[model samples]
Target: MILLQANQVARHFGGETLFQHINLEIKDKSRIALIGRNGAGKSTLLKMLAGEEEPDEGTITRTKNLSFGYLAQHTGLTSQKTVWEEVVSVFESVHAIESQMRELEKLISLESEKGNHADSNNYLEQYAALQQTFLDSNGYGIESEIKSVLHGFRFFESFYDQPVNTLSGGQKTRLALAKLLLEKPDLLILDEPTNHLDIDTLNWLEDYLQGYRGAILIVSHDRYFLDKIVTEVYELSRHQIYHYTGNYSRYLELKAAQQEQEWKAYDKQQAEIAKLEDFIARNLVRASTTKRAQSRRKKLEKMTRLDKPAGDEKSAKFLFQAERQSGRDVLAIEQAAIGYDDTVLSEPVTLHLRKQEAVALIGPNGIGKSTLLKSVTGQIPFLKGAAKLGQNVDIGYYDQEQANLTSRNTVLEELWQEHPTFPEKDIRTVLGAFLFSGEDVKKTIPLLSGGEKARVALAKLSMQKDNLLLLDEPTNHLDLDSKEVLEEALIDYDGTLLFVSHDRYFINRIATSVLELSENGSKLYHGDYDYYLEKKKEEQEVAEMTASKTEAEIPAASSAKRDFQQDKEHQRQKRSLEREIAALEEQLTNIDTHIAELQKQMEQPENLEDHEALTELNNQLTAQMEEQDAVMAEWEEKSLLYEDTY
Candidate 1:
């Protein structure tokens, strides 16, 4: 059954048509992903569907008694109400029925006490009817269900009584989602619902949507979230809606295939037309073949030519130029303790970054990922040690808050300001490439939506030629398509990348290394997010296995025997550590010999004049020294640990 049908829906802002001749039909229990570029009228279409806005042309018809609950990107929650009270408000009608039932019960009891049997009987009957209505509405389990949904979204017990306004934006979004789930409308329309949610909350939402009895239409940039939830995809482009029968990943594959097929058909048709034209041209000049020429001409005139497949071929292509390469030590931090003011949140730590590597810094909110980014960029002071940048390192920073853009400037002005050397036409072209075109470029930065502002920030970043790119939540307000474009651009970017993003799919695609920040401090994983997840899972399984192992399985006669073996192992570790130290010393001796040889060659009267050779030798020596120091430091730490254990 079709729940809603949009016929020839057209929307226009001023003289510009956002979308026209758009036709779409949503069926019962359908899960659709409403996808388009930033300004592609997806939100407008949603509003039209929900009857919040009317289309300039066409009609949106809904089945009778079908209800829709729309969770806008920005939730509107009152400040005075507690979280629990806010969620319970969704069931106010049921509560009202219960209150009526209670009043009827009281009236019946009072009438019976006053010896009014007839009135008492009537009140008792009304009370029974209200009781049935309450039961039918599932009023009994409403509170438990609300609590369960809230818990699924990671709402703590302490937050239940907290005022709604006290929660963060993400918390409020979650609260709104909880209320929507409780309401159990016939259709749910969510715009960037997962924008402010954590991984755990997103996962819970995926589960919730999967089991939802109604249809859902969600617009989100989280590809993983979309893949896990959406059953169908509706792509809005060129004033038309294209429906795909599967999730985001499937949509991508099928769309590529469809484009390929269209291209093939186009090529074949063009070839056929060329052949006909050639035959007609060759036969036209032959005197005896005038009739044949006329017949071919007539066939050509009657031929229906195929229309070429048109799209923005250059929209997906992104390129950046970099100057001289940075030094081998792209970045380094020694004994860096970073925090606000005098409070140190983490211990002194050391880190090193090299060229052509992508690193992702991940942690829970408020655990200092952004602070760490600030420290690395030298925007904030490191309380303990220093953060060192190598020579010729040009940093392209994309801040999470999009602080780079001026509020007063329009999108076009912002782009032009960043690349002042570019002509007006060139700036417009680039802005259009990032999905900002026409009047969209005229919208002031402050007036643009969060997603639009994010796109503008990214477009500005793309214009710079830098050897190092530092991004914070680069995919925050982008759609899945835009995220893919950004991913492709970053993959092709010939630079060192270090970013902090909560988007798992983005991290898995772009990150070559993972740096996890936890209560125990940061730990480095030399793999992408998925690999890190696998490694963590493996460790968890091993720990569980170890915990489940029987003590009897150990070859120990008693606890004393186990203790004695542990002591022996500690002594063994100390001896092994000493051996390892000796080996590192020998390795360092070999490195010193190589450096001395290179130094002596460079010091030669004839070789001293060769700048290239000298530079190469110096770089090699620096790398060797850094490596040796690192190995020696590790050996010293291990030795201390061994001694402590003994």
Candidate 2:
């Protein structure tokens, strides 16, 4: 059931090689992830797989009529239509059927009013057929489907009529994903689909994608999301792709073990090689032992040497340090309201931060998580009660937007300006720790990529040595490795932390407590992200229980109704459709068996020598595959009917 396969896929730039000799296969319903450090050509490889970009040297094969949907990273949908129209566009065929059903309904009503029973019956037949088509195409449930997906993306019905062009960047990105999900392509290729998604929406998407019927190929830095959805991991490293079994966590475990074994084997081989070389060198000069030395030399020449194991040599590295330890009370926020001009997004926020406490601020988008952080730093004035810093507390902020980093200065100057007293080499040393070295430091700030700018901002922040850190989406543009590195640093920081992040893994690793912001106010969960989730789950269960009790006490609606003869006939039609689907499936299986047999025969030595026989076998294989495709289409239609029937 391989939906797509690529052989010897390779891509190259102007005069440099990005990756080569790559091979990949995507099976039906496969949940696959491609992960690597930034600049490792992961996005390029994804584009090639989606058929949006051709590989420089490779052949990609896909099943006939394969449908594919690709969501490039950070690319939002540029639509002039309203949100409702944009999403409904995915159901054009269903809409056509719906129109026909409406026309048939009108004709039947007109005939019945004119006292023409026979004409009405004729119209009724057409209506029934059109209705079946509409149901099979999911026209009846289209609105519900769109609403469900939009809800998962945190879009309510009130926003349905709004123009897509007016939506924020994050909202547009979510809308693009929702549209793709509704389309339900055979292969869904997502590049950083978790971007801009809060924890609640992320959880919803993870649940949806887990039950997705199609294959998925994703390039994301969300380790927690990947662990929940993907079953296979592909690592692109040092110009090659390696496949590993299981989820992201399992892949890490397996990869670490595999790398360790490779190193041990490599070391063992080197020792053996050194021993052999020494023996040959020492004994070759001795006439009495010349034959033995020559034998050893011959053996050494025949032995295959193992290539050195590739490592992550370019992973960003840095550390966070506090200049001075703060008092026991690091920060205090009481009855604080934060928002833009004349708009109160959240109110009555109250919190107490102790020294060396890491707190994560989480909420749905537009709830002022980032604005709250800004208010704390005095960048944006609080609408109500202001935050009060503890005795001798100093603050450093990491803006997710990198607003303070808009400069024409070189990367070196960006950091060096903050501490003019430090020597040039000393400034470069700190930059080098963050993988900005040599010519990289001379590059202008505007030319740096999102990831590069993030590192530079961090480099500057780390040097400030503030005891209180306020970060907003610190893992926004980081690759998986860099995010882990930052997480490790923040986890070990001696100062107190209050950051806003959508990265669940990052929050779990760093946050000692969770502060959940809402439109009404803020509530503190005195535990890590996981503990917060557990409490939320318990609350949801209680709410559901209360709802169930209320529902039970209310009067029951009348029992459902269906026309007796019509219902019996519908059941019969459903059974017939199931039988047809089963038959088509069996036919496809038989065709596949024949195709396999033909391929095996073509590989036989006698068939290979006989060109005529080989050609015949190849022709037969192609014919069988064509037949399978036709049968598969029929089976799909029948299955759809079975699922959609009344």
Candidate 3:
């Protein structure tokens, strides 16, 4: 069923049409992505769909009583309640039903005491109906569900009781998202949902959204996230929206093909039109050929004209170049700790980056990825140990916050002031290459958006001819198109790179090696993000295997005498897994016995008469059932492993 539809929608701002005649459908459980360059009206279109903004022309039709939720790019939760309280508020209906259920229980008891059997039966009926509603709404599992979502967004128990008003902007945004997920709206609209998420949380969200019951209409610049979750893509460009049936990568392919076919058809039609016009002009004066010319002109006039294909929108253009090569070792950090004011974020870290190596530094937010970059650039003093630059290494840094930019200077003046010796025209040309032209060049730095500032920073960095570039979240404000442009430039850059970014797609594209920073220390993975994940998973499996062996109560005699130590290790692991499986099955059996007892209690007439006792027992039963399921799952997994090992 089509949950929502926009018919011939159009939006205008400042007498300029942002988009017109836009039509799309949000069908039941639809997974659609809206993509475009910055300023292409994606957010405006999203707002229209979300009913937060009205279209200048045409109509938006949503199903009657359809629940809608919108999460804007910077939406934050501001409340006096604690984080848990704020999130649980989304389930106000469930809470209301629960309260009514309790009230009904009291009335039912009062009527029973008064021997008003009819009144008691009516109250019991109402209470029973309300109880079913509560169950359907997941009232019993509300706390567990909230905790699952909070955990996915990297919120721990310690943060749950924190006042929502006291949280940081990012945390507030995350909390808003968590609440939205709990609400389970029929139509969920997310604008740049990946904005404040780290890689781990991004992965969790992708998994969560894939199984979301409601339709999702999202506008995001994160290609990887879009690819993972969305099955259909809508490219909003040149005052229109074009639908493409695929993920972002597949959309690129189809879009390219469609553009090529469109251009070809247009070119062929133009050629035929030109030929007919030329024939008409040459033959109209002649007696014998005049009839033919007139016929051709009539045919040409009747033919439908095709508009030119939309592609090749203005995009940022720049490149990274090195004036000189650095030594074999581009940069080295030995036993270094990075932090400020007597604080250390990481243990003594050691890393050696070679010439022309692009290394990505990744970790959770606030674990000091940015601090390490600043320490490397000498913008901040290292807390401990030595950070050394190889011979003849000239460094260029792109601050994620764009802090180094002079706020009062115009875009042109910013670049011009950096290289005063360069001609004004040349500076303007460079600015134009970065998509700053005409009036845009005159915009003061402070007035420019984050993306514009990033471009100005990039333009400046492109000119520096440095042997090493230390970037902090270089892709932060860049749109998908601009990010691709930057990725291509970096791919071709001969200089060494040591940058910190939360964009997994960008890291996968640009990084030759992965440096994982943690509280323990820095560990190097000798591959891209995918390879890093593969290695990480393998290590986890090994760790689990070792843990099972250590936790097992297996006797030494269970391992067969082996000629090789590896054989002994294998036999030992097999025996240990067998023991674990047996233990899980035994636990499952006990849980089943407990569940049976609870069921017996629930079926008792006397127990059912006591609402409070019944409710408490029901909650416990639900928890026990959930625990049993976990145990059963563990048993199945362990059984499979045992079979494979034996």
Candidate 4:
């Protein structure tokens, strides 16, 4: 059944059409992801669906008495109310019925025997109906369930009694989510719900949403979150909607295949058109075939030509020109204790960031990740120990706060001021790459959004390349599509990257090493995010097994004990080897898949016709295949180790 439908929805602002002729149907239990570039009317469309905003030209139809919840980027819960009270308010109707039922029960119990006979039936009927309604609504357990949902979202015991207004923005968002969960709407629309969440909360949300009974429409920049929760993607672009029936990963694959097919069809059609044109040009003057030529010309004129497949021509390309390579020690910190004034968060630590290495700093909120970053950057002095930057290291910083942008300057003015020698067109192109097109370029920095401001900051950084790039949450406020563009640019970049991000997909793609910050300080791991996760999981399994073995020990026969010890060692070694093999095989499979995709791109006639791109694709494929072979060798070695242990 269709839960909501928008027919010919047209929304306009200040005589400018945000979207027109927009038709959409959201069905019962449909998990849709509303995706678009920033400011492409995704939020507006969602509002229209939610009936909070009326369309200028069409009708939105929803099921009668249907409950739908919209969690905006910002929620409007009053600050005076406690978190528990705010959540409990969702069951106001059920609570009211319960109160009425309790009052009737009290009156019936206290009635006289003579009056009780006549009043008993009436009171019993009302009591029975209310009790049934309450049970059906799960009224008895509503409070417990609300508490559970709030706790799952990391709302601590101390936070439950705190006034909503006193909470930070992130805490308020969490409280709003808890309230929405308790409401149990038939349809849930969330906008960037994961922005304020820590990794643990994000994981908890994933588990919660996985089993959610209602339909969900989420707009998030977190690729991993979207992949985990959404079953379908609705991309709002160019004033139209494109549907992809799968998770983000599958959507990427299908989108690539579709683009490839479109390109092929386009090439075929162009070839036929060329052949027709050539015939007309060669035979138009011939007296014997003049009529045939005229007919051919008419057919050519009437033919509907295929438009070329659109590409992200304006996507930022990082053509970094580093001044010079840094020394072997890019950065070193010893006995480092980092944090703000009167709050030394991290314990004493020692770490090293080597030259030409990309490192990602990851941790939960309030874990001193950003503090450590600031200390390394020399923006904040470490409470203890020393931080040293290598000789002649030029650093470019991209902070989420976009502190470099001047509110009074226009985009052009900012770029021109930064790079006086750069040409106007080049500056405009760069700005366009960051989605500041036409009059948007003329807009003042003060008027720009958080995302746009961040892009501007990135654009400024791209103008002057450096050997070291220290980015703090560079992917924050960016859409998934924009994130992909950034990923590509970063992949092609030559500078060393030291950045902080919660985006696992971005970290997995770009980081050559991981720096995990915890209460114990920072620990460096020599692998990407996925590798780190695998290692952690293996460690946990080993710990669990050791605990179990210790609990089940038999302290009797020495020979039996020795044999048991030997068996346990052998089993541990076997499991370790098996895990190693599994990890290697997973890497090999991924490399093979990437190589196959590159090969497909290389085989495209359009790409092949472009000699430069074809050559690049061929080189990439060869490199990926070599990597795959290395991984396979490692896989075989681990397999052999497992066999020997067994």
Compute each candidate's TM-score over C-alphas.
Answer: 0.78, 0.82, 0.83, 0.80
Model 2 lDDT tens row, 176-282: 99999999999999999999898899999999999999999999999999999999999988888999989999999999999999999999999999999999999
Model 3: per-residue Cα lDDT over 1-646, one tens digit each: 8999999999887889989999999899999999988888888888888888999999999998999899998899989999888888888889999999999989999999999999999999999899999999889998899999999999899998999999999999998988898889998999988988888899999999999999999988888899898999988888888999989999999999998999999999999999999999999999999999999999999999999876699878878999865544568898888888988888778898866789999988888899998888777888888788876689999898898899889998898887999998899888888999889899999899888899999999998999899999999889998999999999999889999988888999999899999888799887799999999999999778666774343444245533578878889999899889778867866776677688779879998999998998999898986786677567767856776775
Best by TM-score: 3
Q: For model 4, how does the per-residue alpha-carbon lDDT over 1-646 read when each residue is reduced to its tens digit?
A: 8898888888888878888888777887888888888878988998888878999998999998889999988664666888877888889999999999999888777664557766877888888999999999998998788878988877777877888999887788888887887888999989888887877688889999889988898988888889999889988777777789999898889889988998999999899889888988888899988888889889989988889987643455445556554543567888788788857787766777755678998877888877777777778888888878875578888877887788899988988898889898989988877777789899999988888887888888888778888889999988777788788888777667889888988999999889888777877777898898887898899778666664335343334656767888888888888888778766765765676588679779899799999889988977885676567567656755775674
- Candidate 3, run of 10 with poorest lDDT: 550-559
TM-score attained by model 1: 0.78
| Model 2 segments more than 4 A misplaced | 108-126, 544-646
> Between 3 and 4, whose TM-score is larger?
3
What does candidate 1's lDDT look like per residue over 108-222, in tens digits?
8899999999999998888888888999999898878888898987787888899999988778877888888899999999988887666656767888889999999888778
Write the candidate numbers in order of decreasing TM-score.
3, 2, 4, 1
Q: Is candidate 2 or candidate 4 better by lDDT?
A: 2
